[model samples]
Target: MSGKTVIARFEQGKETFEILVNSDLAYEYITGKRKDPMSVLDAEEIFKDARKGERQGEEKIKKAFGTTDMATVVDHILKKGDVPITTEQKNRLMEEKRKQIIDIIARNSIDPRTNAPTPALRVENAMNEARVSIDPFKGPNEQVEAVVKKISLILPIKFAKIKINVNIPPEYSNRCYGILKQYGLKSEEWLSNGSLSAVVEFPAGMQTEFYEKINNATQGRAETKILE
Candidate 1:
């Protein structure tokens, strides 16, 4: 034990578990920087009360987790459990996740006014201006929309993409399906007449080229409509 430890707790219906583990290591392990959950442990033991060092029993462990194997139990505890962290650590992780959200928006979005890619710095400034709060523990993809919505109130921003509903004749559907997948096939369905009805999206800048390629591939037989 390094003695620099914190209690990571997990609780649910009939399951109350805790472990005393190094705080920094548990944080890294939960965020995927550290793979070996066992390595994060200060002691290879599960506790009903970590502060008191009360060891939980095997039958209860097996009942709660479906197995009492120490490695498996530890993995579940470290992952599903809450590892209390310092405010400084929480702030640092929040900052990193904020940068990820900004990068994603800047890469795939644009200023609707001129259809120009919004600079990352501009996005960051708007985020600060909007006072967007980011969740460090939540994945960036999950938070992008909410952050974008908040930032959009302060900046003229929108994702730079065009969605097209395309209908392909049976002979060409199979061939064009692969092409649509390459673009960004959102939703697809087969018609009663053996045709393919699908929606595909691509970067706005590729609008002209996308139509040309699809038209040529389907030999002018594919029908398409621009979605709002």
Candidate 2:
């Protein structure tokens, strides 16, 4: 008696084949080891057949592998034999998503016309406005300065870095700086050339007011760089 094991199969109404292998066999066989004379296909042969011809077509093979589509189903069972991404990877992916959300919030603020500021920008503008409103006086210069100060102040503290640019005349510049300074902004680095160019720091938020302000302030002399 041979100490060989047989792998038998019956396909409902179809013909059955028996595969056999020695119990002590250490190497895999490309061709199936058959104890019965009816075996006609090896493991490679079956797989090749599964990939081609009407024997194992697209729909039939997918059904066998229990997948909805031929793309992943075929690859999953034939190549990897399992889904890859683990729970840990999923958690890390979620963390990355959360970080992205935080970034968006920190960088952008709402539109005054729209009332929807990004998280970081919102914090800066709101805080700056709150600080400015406490001054017991307000004007065009103070209003503009208040908002700019809000943007400038929040950016450095929350995001740690970013630059803002303001272009106001010598007459208005002094008042602008005064308002910003009054809001606890501490830097002359924000003041630019003699042509009313003041650079402040903040995150990348939509500068709706900045755009409209430039056209109004210098009568279109100042141009804002908008990133699409």
Candidate 3:
């Protein structure tokens, strides 16, 4: 397996220099021994470490110059595509990820309404209403477009396209539209009651699943007149 050599450049006060290495040379630089070319990820890391060593050597050259060119120094560094990761850097990333997961698990454990229980349960219930708002520029097909776009991110479908009809006061029509849009539905003006009726489509077929999610999210106030 052959790959191109890497040249990493850096600058000192007035002089610019580079380190040139083939895959074999990078392996030796990283592991202190030569080995065959390996995965791109491994090779990249090795090259980054070698570049660090190269930078140290270049620093000595800078002392000879009375003034430093920042732009030239930056350009030299950019020529190297990979960034080195130190052990401390890796550890810090891992710790951040661990904290994020712990937070999510804690959040999902609670009961939102009663607040009587763990955050995990509340989060689980909340996920049902977690929706991607439909973009209006797509036109009336906004709801349809949303389902197609975001279905992959949701849990496996319980059913296909459960329909819901919504009616809201003419004054609050926009607010209702916003709410429906939250559930990935598109709202259009309806002649009846001058109140708008929006059709919300969901992948879940059962009325129970659809209504339960809608009621929970809208606080049982979002009226839905299911039309078959």
Candidate 4:
């Protein structure tokens, strides 16, 4: 398959430098999926010269990057990119991330000072104050660790995972099955009497909210057990 391309650029004061590499590799580096910044050079094709000696080709690449230090050039390339995302697109992405952050907090975190679930509004406000940076291309769950670190400065938070066993009576099984399925139901069985029993796993922070939801859907008739 053919490879994709991307241009990385650096500008400081009055000087500018640029390098070209496989777009996939550049994204891997940008997203922390690739550990070595210099790896970009392994796939580098910017200095193609069959007639020139290796030393000459190296010199040309360095000159093009305006630096002899590979590390410095890699740093510059990583910081700047050729593709530009629009402001509107950025705002929409931030909004989506903001909601994800709020949902995570509302579901998984409690105010240590009060031992109560932190309100979504409070989390939103704290996130805004912290000026958290959201990666538009990355899923919120994937970015949660860094985001939590930043927001922790403004709010007390903890993350936990929970597993639940739910039993829905025949009267409610059909009505509540769909809701339970969305919460990561692991295994489910239909009892002889037409009841439904399911084991589900989800983040602990969402436990209270999820319980309330399941109860409401089943009119407090569903039985639940927190396994973890």
| Candidate achieving the largest TM-score | 1
Tens digits of per-residue lDDT for model 3, 1-228: 453465544444454554444543343333324433232222322121354653333334345332235333322343222323345543543444333432333422222233222333333333335543432112222233334234324322222344568766565565556557755584466766566767875433234544655566555666777556
Looking at candidate 1, the ten consecutive residues that score lowest on lDDT are 202-211
- Measured against the true structure, the TM-scores of the candidates, in listed sequence, are 0.59, 0.23, 0.30, 0.54
- lDDT score, candidate 4: 0.69
Instruction: List runs of model 1 lying over 4 Å from the truth.
Output: 1-3, 55-80, 160-228
Candidates 1 and 4, the one with greater TM-score? 1
Worst 10 residues of 2 by lDDT: 23-32
lDDT of each: 0.83, 0.37, 0.42, 0.69
> Which rank order by TM-score, best down to worst?
1, 4, 3, 2
**Candidate with better TM-score, 1 vs 2:** 1
- Better model by TM-score, 2 or 3? 3
The sequence of per-residue lDDT tens digits that candidate 1 reaches over residues 1-228 is: 333788888786876788878988887876779888788888888898878889888888888889988778887877666768778878988888999888888767768898766778999999999999997667788999999889887888777788889999998888888889988999999988889999998766455666778899999999999899
3 or 4, which is superior by TM-score?
4
Best of the two (3, 4) by lDDT? 4
Clashes of each: 0, 12, 12, 3
Q: Clashing pairs in model 1?
A: none
* Candidate 4 lDDT tens digits, 1-228: 223554555544444445555555665565557777777654433324212312224565566566667666675557453433446645765677668867876787766666556778878888789998787656677777787788888898776567889999999999888888788889999999999999998766677778889889988989988784
Residue range with the least summed lDDT across 10 consecutive positions in model 4: 47-56
Residue-level lDDT tens digits of model 2 in 1-228: 323432222121232212222322201111123332222223321131332321334444434555544334322332222112335533543444334433454445444443333554355355545553322111122343344455554443222233444556554555455443432332444334554454554433534434454456455565333222
